[model samples]
Target: MKNKILVLGSLTLLSASLLVMNSCNSLPKGLKTIQDFDKNKYLGSWYEIARLDFVFEKNLNNTTAEYSLNEDGSIKVVNRGYNFIKNKYVASTGKVKFAGDSNEGKLKVSFFGPFYSGYNIIALDSDYKYALVAGESLKYLWLLSREKTMPNNIKETYLKTAKDLGYNTSELIWVKHN
Candidate 1:
């Protein structure tokens, strides 16, 4: 009986430790979240100007993301897009929490329960009109803007930055807002 109780306690402790470790995820190597990121300013809506082809967003166009504060202080994410091939609209809701410090742009977003992925904001304009976001690896990158269209200069600059970070900028798919 005592041996069984000890084993249970050990398992409980190990489970708790794993939970803690998962909650404290870090950004991918060679990527850094922006400093002094204000979540409040980042809230509201953003248009997906460009992105690398990812399964969740494949064949999607006219994509936009809405962010709001959840009751538990996590960011509520609503991603909506039009599937041109399917001729239908699709959306997925998720939650985002700071991976580390709240002031940094490093966050983990989960659409599936208890399974989080990195959402690191690598760059942003002072007015929060445009942002460059990186996922867990070079495979996932997004260029977002407050409006449907992004400026030429900003697009060029962000593409250069992504390329510098070892991303294949040529593979980027420019999202159509119409």
Candidate 2:
């Protein structure tokens, strides 16, 4: 009687958790999973050229990301930036795990939540000169580079890739380097 009731309650909780997880992120038809990203080339510093303007990083500039391999085989994503509004540098650390096709350059990242979001690498330079990132939707896009700015051709190519991925490139805020 009591055990049966407890079992039923546990099952209900698990079912609810799964539903919540699925509802967290709305992915596109061919959205890449954790298995898509390349870990070796993915590591290093990537400058933020544009983004969808999350409130946390709003009014921020000189944004950069430093990634490293953690002890547990997870990638440590450390995003640092200088917020003009807050008048201070902010750092956000999050863990990233691979899903779907690891070699295909697609991954899902979570920032301390059960809900993992898309972090796909749609374009990258051979010399690692620049990288174009597309998040879960048409709004989440970023262009990064080793230097503060990139060449016109590279930038154009990246922008076109973002647009093809269903992002509105016009909204990309040109990051002002400090």
- What is the number of residue pairs that collide in model 1? 0
**Candidate lDDT values, in order:** 0.92, 0.76
* Candidate 2 TM-score, C-alpha based: 0.80
Query: Each candidate's TM vs. the true structure?
Result: 0.86, 0.80
lDDT by residue for model 1 (49-142), tens: 9999999999999999999999999999999999999999999999999987899999989998887888999999999999999988788899
Q: Report the C-alpha lDDT of model 2 over 42-113, residue by residue, as the tens digit.
A: 789888877778776788999999989999987889999998887999998887776445576566677766
Q: At residue 137, what lDDT does model 1 achieve?
A: 77
Clashing pairs in 2: 34-98, 34-99, 35-99, 35-100, 35-101, 35-102, 36-101, 36-105, 36-106, 37-106
Q: What are the runs in model 1 whose C-alpha is more than 4 Å off?
A: 1-24
lDDT value for model 2: 0.76
Q: Evaluate model 1: give its TM-score.
A: 0.86
Candidate 1: how large is its RMSD? 4.4
